[model samples]
Target: MSEPGSSVAAVVVAAGRGIRIGGGMPKQYRRVGGQAVLTRTLDALGGDPVIGRIQVVIAADAAAFFETCRAELSPAVADKLLPPVEGGATRQDSVRAGLEALAAAGAPDVVLVHDAARPFVDSELIARAVAAGRDHGAAVPGVAVADTIKLVEDRDAIGRVRETPARENLRAVQTPQAFAFGLLRAAHRAAAEEGLHAFTDDGALAEWAGHAVVVFAGDLRNRKITQPADLIEADRAFAGPSATGSGAETAKDIAMTTYVTRLGTGFDVHAFTEGDHVWLGGVKIPADRGVLAHSDGDVALHALTDALLGAIADGDIGTHFPPSDEQWRGASSDRFLAHACTLVRARGGRIDHLDITVLAEAPRIGAHREAIRARIAEICAVPLTAVSIKATTTEKLGFVGRAEGLAAQAAATVRLPEDAEADPVDAQAETAMRQG
Candidate 1:
């Protein structure tokens, strides 16, 4: 598009409250197609070879939500993210903040301003935006309007049509609106000085700043999630045939029907040591003592990680992150679980469910079940409903009963492509485990 490598950066505006979607949280944070809208948006942009970096603008109160969302992304994609900046009151302010952040970090050749709600923006569309921006200085993707257009006046309960515009001349604009890094930055800076912050999109702001904004072709399927119905429609698109209707072909009915369901189990234990808290299932819990291990000693996450690896016939947590490795000593176990999930996804597999049971007489899990369930779901990139947590005691029979140690057993269910090959490194470990 703009030569082979033209140094592109993107600013994803996700600060909006998105109340129209009616979710308890912001619409961008809500899950559609089993993933957050913002996560999908980041993945789409980060997956592109041409884009070098990304900056996200979020509400000040959304840091925790954003972190959970970020945890769901692949490591490669997550690596492209910049520390998120807090947004302002209006969309214009939020965009300006993002642009300023990008500029401060050394501006790129071209900058793309995208909406986090539009998760369907593909690499081709991004490439087109870059090319058009380089050629025209400013360009926005627009789809030609198909319906009749009308101007309305609101003088009564129902607005009346005052004028009709020609259908051929009407176009609906969408984003990943592109511009020369210098040109857009100057426009935003000038607008801030002049108190001109009413513009809804960067394209409009550039046009207001006397820059001729060209319109390139836009995709119809690249719809934004502004309403609840829009979210539902997008969810159904990714959720597959069952989400659509009964008449749709099931997975078995389709060709290349090699997908199969499998289950794996794992158990882990850690002796209590001198500490004030314990990390379980990626959540820290106040306790009389902590577990003795090389890592954070998160027995729940350790067992779950092993379970996921076992599901795909891969290596256990220890096999992947050996305690002997100095780098893994005192490391967070969440990383191990996340790595396991990534391995499952690499082989074209999807986790169906994860269940964990903890055997501990002290630090009862009843009070922290929901939090643990949520953290695991976030790490696995699965719905909360798909995770189950339970706890029990050995009734003074063994180490767990005597409160000397905590143990956890986990089960993982996953669907994988039958043709997926076993990872050679993990295969050796699996064989060793069998033999031992």
Candidate 2:
């Protein structure tokens, strides 16, 4: 792993009680726009190659919550999140916990501290933090405050005005704050030693500890949702950016059709069967003997399963419904086809079209092509236009030519949702829904 280089370790603090967002799940776990804030934060950081590892600090009881919510999260988000550590009593305590976890894992040069509640993070802000931290040892993203500063007093009583802080000199700090591992550790230790807890952010802590802190221009899109209003704003920010529900993606490129890829193939064979029926394309072909195999020996189903699985990067049929299983003995080939469809749907990839060819010299497949196609269409739940079936045979040359067994080939075409790219569940759902 080459020690992972001077990579960015994103420490996402998901420990806070987010009452404002008002979901049973914490604000970090609550869906921002359509995605959970925790999920989006993990995705944003984990998607960056510059970021090597991500450590999430959650409350002790949140483990069950995390596990339960796993299916709701995108795979990209889930894969990036390191097993979460239990956070402490305060925000600083959580930071310390995160830092400790990072250290135990062989500390990266710079660890970026962030809040999982802040889901609107973009790559540019992280890139700035990493580039600056590499040079200056400490850097944090901040946005210019548009709201006026206020030091509030008793609401019912008249209060003297507190000195107004200089707006020009102030910045509303947003994460991620990137810092050298050793420097941040020492600063936290020093803060603990002095009994100082006045710091609000990593920048403030770094300043209190006498380390030179550098600021970078942060993005407006990097807003955090601490209150209810912030959630509304976060919704607008991300939903406006979403290409899925919104048709905004079409404006960027007009020629963009939901592209469907094409693949074509041919197969033929003759089965020397003593049996009375042959399973072909999940349909039984009336014959004297079925093709020989470890399972029901449906070569047609196996080939079709491969074509469908291959389109989605899922392994072949044997990899899933192994013929080695006693359970598969005399199993209906429809089960294998159903599983293949499941994989395609789970990945949000849809089978646009599929063609299956069965070559048999015995019980001519020409009369049953429509019935086989309809059966496949029913299993895949696609329109009849999306399914095809054909059959042919050689003039007695090879094993298939000599009627030793049945042979089949399939071509599967698939498409993935552009807006929800890098997600498997959405891919799966979209595929299943469209096919269904």
Candidate 3:
């Protein structure tokens, strides 16, 4: 385990061909939400303040494709990114190669090993992994298993269920699995020395090496893009706010069925409280007083979250995260916005744009406008060019004018598949897919 201020790095394994996805290029090279899957994964890791450096493992012949995707990343991510390392034939081999590279370049105290195909990872998950890794030598993120799992015997034409595992004790694990850099490196070396290359994940390898690994809470939206339809869904979720907007370039690849455009608007208000700063659009801005609310009181993000939910006919933020829920007392509003975005994508919808207006007389937003826009863009997994944030005062006429509180209004535009408009048609499609 590492110390309080230990250095942290990440290794993104992107070398696999991903044949099941059926794209001419590797699945990591596929575009999702206007960005390459690998690029998005890198951004998600690099954007977090806890992670210091990132190294990517790519196929030997994919340098050109990797560079093309690399060029499109946010400047901040590019700065933390290291030169790509050549990966091996298997996922295990790729991770070992990455670890070796980091060891050669001065190993960090902790290393987060992640798959390039899962691009929806967020800062909260990363923070949890880091903390768990620090406390334990190894850690992985997991969600509770919602469905009964069967142990099957596949010796015959049709597999037979041997036993059913209790769902309460089961967990579905995902990565950016975290580990103490030295422990993981040593485990990989030991496994290689023993000719053990079949371990599915680093956590398993560590467990085999006799290290205790813990599982932390994971985000549901951190799904892997393993199939063709997953790519389509990710693309829709990341689509720009307009056909001619940032995601226009990839629209042709995503629109596989009839779609309908939708618009949703939301408004929120928060009174002033005694504090030094306030949160806005996921960016913490210096202010004379903070806003009073259940969450961090990010008016801009709350309105945007509600707007996104509205676009998909989902309930408002209050319905999803009630004010009475103590669990959400100081929750970050970005989580709320991301959840809303996930709901939109789950229904095969694409976000076209998000426009927000902030009303306040004190703690002017003029200086933080671009920062706010960038933060919103990151949270929504959209391009900064696609998010619009504007601020104006109430002209000293109302509560905002008298500096009593801050208010924000937001509008969201989205495009959803036609089947989403009719429940029966969507249900029919689901049934047909299952039968086929």
Best by TM-score: 1
Clashes of each: 0, 11, 4
Tens-place lDDT digits, model 3, residues 55-76 = 8999886775676556666688
Q: Rate the local accuracy (lDDT) of all candidates.
A: 0.84, 0.70, 0.84
Top model by lDDT, which number? 1
In candidate 3, which residue ranges exceed 4 Å CA deviation? 1-4, 155-157, 240-436
Give residue 182's lDDT in candidate 1 (0 to 100).
93
Candidate 3 minimal-lDDT segment of 10 residues: 240-249
**Better by TM-score, candidate 2 or 1:** 1
Candidate scoring better on lDDT of 2 and 3:
3
**TM-score, prediction 3:** 0.56
Candidate 2 global CA lDDT score: 0.70
lDDT of candidate 1 over 1-436, digit per residue (tens): 3466568999999999887777445889776555678987898888887888999999986775677667777788899899999999889999999999998898998999999999888877888999999999999999999999878897676788999999888889999999999999999899999988877889989988999999999888678989988877666564553432111334443343245788989999999999999999899999888889999999999999999999988878878999999999999998899888877765657678899999999898888999998888767766678899999989898988888999999999988766565567778999999999
Q: Could you give the candidate ranking by TM-score, starting with the highest?
A: 1, 3, 2
